[model samples]
Target: MLRIMLRHISLLILTLFILSFFSFSLAYLFPGDPLVNLTGIRDSSEQTYALLAQQYAMNDSLFSQYWHYVNNLFSGNWGLSFSSGLPLAEEISRSLAASVELSAYALIISFVIGLPLGFLSGLRHHKFIDYSLLSASVIGYSIPVFWAALIAILLFSVQLGWFPLSGRISLLYDIPYDTGFILIDILLSDVPDKEFAFQDALRHLVLPSVSIAIVTSTIVLRITRRSVVEVMNSEYIQAAYARGLSPRQVFVRHGIKNALIPILPLLVMQFTTLLTNAMIVETIFSWPGIGNGLIQAIYQRDFPAIRAGMLAVSALVLTFTITSDMVIQIFDPARRRPEDATS
Candidate 1:
């Protein structure tokens, strides 16, 4: 078990190192001077260009620049943004908080709605319920996330006026940015009309959250249904039935527990996917997240922001993948077997 964990950790470190290298090397791969993009200046004196280059350490060799960037990243010094001139770490912190909040809400919604539907579909097998769920899952999976978000805004925000079309909260509230999480900040705040602020924040959250959840839930639903159906056919499940356990009892006590073994790893991967999808979702809803920031950086040609954002996203995905592997090995005893470990 320890060996497997160590191996996974080592692989994770190597993957991160490679990811960082590529992210840094992206500047060199593209044509033209990166400083032009970073500075947003088409014309500058030679001295001014030299100063900007030196300021960003662009004057250094590729290897030296990457070494410094990696060191700065590890030391929590993401450097200043080229456009805004704000500390990149602070910007990332704010954006990351919003993204986390949005993703967390979407994940909760996906599991809450998807799991029961999946369970029913699986229990029913080839029956009407199963077909209905399968159909829905396919349709949901096929819909583009951005289109879904737009439609949600049209119905929920524009026509119905049930939710806000953009932003994380109404401009009406002056909620303190304590934790960078508006929901928590609202609760912890001593602002007047705290309830109103909370409600407004929730309203702003619904459309974008649902947009992401609608797409991601399909994956959970399909996986859960398939896993549950397979688990139901296992010998132990048949034995439980023979021992006079009710169908519901057998399902609740035995089926879901075993089915979850496979579902967990899929869910972990789903988390990373959801974060990646957030880039589009955030842009659509104008949600102030790293995804939104990244898109804006691209448009403005802010290379520092671009590199940092991409690296951050890639590192997050890789970290989650590694963590999920370790968790799966810990929970699934079959994976801990000698043959499994060797394989």
Candidate 2:
């Protein structure tokens, strides 16, 4: 197991090394001078732009600058934003909590609703319940996320007036900043200031969260149903049934554990996908997050913000993938041999 982990870790490092160079180059590949773009120096004298570019080190050769960028990253300097002139780390830190909060809520809802429905759908097989669940899954998977989010807002917020139309919270409320997450802040605070803003933020989150959840839940539902069905036919399951164990007992005790082994990797991958989706959803809802920050950075041609955000997202996704792989090795019968356990 240790060897396997070390091998994966090495591969992860290599992958990131390659990815960092490519991500950096792609941002630099665009036409126009970086400093000129930053300063909007079009129509200025060539000498003026040249001086500023040299001052910002943009006049350095691409290879030299890229090598410096890599060295700085290793030395723990992530660089500064061209847009706000703030440290890239600080900008990302400010937005990270909101992005994580949105993704966490969507993931929780996906698993909670998807897993049980999937299990029932698999257990029922050809029955009406199974058909209904499958149909819902298909619809959920087919709908475009942005379209679904807009429709949800139209129906829930516009027609029904049941939820807030946009933004994280009402401007009127005095929301405490213990944590960047509005919901968490509300939970930890006194009730007096929590009324409008807390509820408003939550209501605003629902459409985007549900839109993300619905799309992602399809993958979970389908994978879970298939895995459960396969587990239901395993030798141990048959033996439990032969011993006159109740259907429910056999399903819970003998089936779920085995079925989930294959599902764990996909579950972890779903969180990464949820984060990507949240980018678009956050923009639509005007919720301030890494996605919005990235967009703003891009428009301003801020290389540091782009690189830092890209690196941050890359690190997070890889971390989840590594975690899932480790979990899989632990639970998977084929991988959990004596040799694996000892290693």
Candidate 3:
């Protein structure tokens, strides 16, 4: 396990380095001059451009620039946004919490609804329940996230008036940004009508979250159903049944444990997907998150903000993937053997 973890960590470091290089390079390669965007004066003098370039390290060689970026990144200096003139880290920090909170809610919804539906579908394979769940999963997976979000807003917010149209919380609550996560900030706040504030935040969260959840849940349901069905049909499962164990006992002891091995890693990938999807969902719903911030940065040609956001998201996805691999090795018995360790 230790060896496996160390290997994964090494791979993670390498992956991040590669991701950073591409993200940084792409920012420069993209059509548009960051200097022009920054100065907002297209006909700036060459001297002015030179001075700005030196100040922002734009005059440096690509390799030197990347070295400085990595060094600054390690030292927790994310540089200043070209447009806002604020630290990139600070801007990202403000939006990161919202994205994290939204993703968390979406994951919770996916698991709560997906797991049981999948399990039962597998148990009753080829029956009505299986067919019904499979059909639902297909529909859920097929629906575009943005389309779903729009429909939800129109139905729930426009016509029904059950949820807020956009934003993380009601403008009525002057909730100070403590953790950037509205729910946590609301709970920690000293404001009156705390319950109302929290409820408002949750109401705003529901539409976007459900949009992400619907797509992710379909993935979870399909994987879970396939895994459970495969495990149930295995020879070992049949032997356990032959030993006179109750159906429930056999399932609890053997079926779920084995089935979960595959499901765990898939769930981790699902989380990564959810984070990426959150960007589109955030934009459509007008939710304040890193995704929305990224879009704004792109529109403004804020190179620093764009690079920082991309690096942060790539690092997060890589971290989750590596962590999930380590967890699977720990829990999945088939991978525990010394011979399988290297593999």
Candidate 4:
């Protein structure tokens, strides 16, 4: 067990090192002068371009600069944004919660709704309901997120006027970004009409969150259906059925947990995917999240913000991957042989 833990830690460390190097290298990959793009100051008036490079340590060797960036990252000094001239870490802190909150809602929507439907479709097997679910999953997975988001905005926001077009809250509420999580901040705030503010925030969340959920949930449904069907076909499940137990009893007692083993890892991967997709969704809906900020950073060539964003995201993905492995190993004790446990 200790050996396995050590191995995971070592791999995580090594992967992070590689990821950090790659993220740092991204800044240097700009086609032309990154400073010029970031600052819009050329060889003409306000030729502080040379000074800017020195200020940001762009004059240093690539290795030296990367080492510095890594040191700063570790020491909680994420440097400054090229565009806003704000602290990169602070900006990320402000944006991180929004992205995470949005993704969390989407993740919940995918799993809460997808799992039951999957189990039902799997149990139904060759029935009409099964085919119907399969078709829906395929169509949901096929649709592009951006296109779906646009349609949602056009139909729901513009035409029906059921939801807001963009932003996390109604413009009427001048609530500060207290915790970055809109709903939470609205509650903690001493503002009047708390219930109204909360409702508006929730309404704003529904469209984008549902759009992402529709896409991500499809994959979850497919994976879960396949896993459940395979588990149902297993000899143990058949034996349970032969013992005169009801199908529901057999599935609840013997099949459900085992079926989860395969989908467990996939679910975590889906969270990572959720975060990735949230970037585009956030940008489209003008969400105040890390995804939107990262998109803007790329457009403006904000090297500090870009590199920091990459590092943070890469680290999160690696962490989630490791966590998923640990969860799987723990969930399926059958994998832990006597010899392995003794070791």
| TM-score list, all predictions | 0.92, 0.85, 0.89, 0.87
Q: Candidate 1 residues 1-343, lDDT tens each?
A: 7777888899999999999999878777755787675555668999998898887689888778888778888898876787789988888888987887888888888898888888889989999879988999999999999999989888887898888889988888888789988999999999999999999998888888888998889988988898999999999999999999999899889998999877877876788777777778999989999999999988877777888888888887789888887878877777676865665
Which consecutive 10 residues in model 3 have the weakest lDDT in total?
34-43
- After superposing candidate 1 on the true structure, give the runs of residues whose Cα lies further than 4 Å from its correct spot: 35-60, 336-343
lDDT of 1: 0.85
- Candidate 1 similarity to native, TM-score: 0.92
Please list all clashing residue pairs in model 4, or write none if there are none.
Answer: none
Top-down TM-score ranking: 1, 3, 4, 2
132-228 in candidate 4: lDDT tens per residue?
Answer: 9999999999999999999999999999999999998888888877878888899899998999999999999999999899988988888899999
Whole-model lDDT values for every prediction:
0.85, 0.80, 0.85, 0.84
Q: Residue 263 lDDT in model 4? A: 82
Q: Considering lDDT, which of the candidate structures 1 and 4 is the better prediction for this target?
A: 1
Candidate 1, residue 57: Cα displacement in angstroms equals: 4.3
Candidate 2: C-alpha RMSD to true structure equals: 3.3
143-247: candidate 3 lDDT, tens digit per residue? 999999999999999999999889988789899889887899999999999999989888999999999999999988999999999999999999999999999
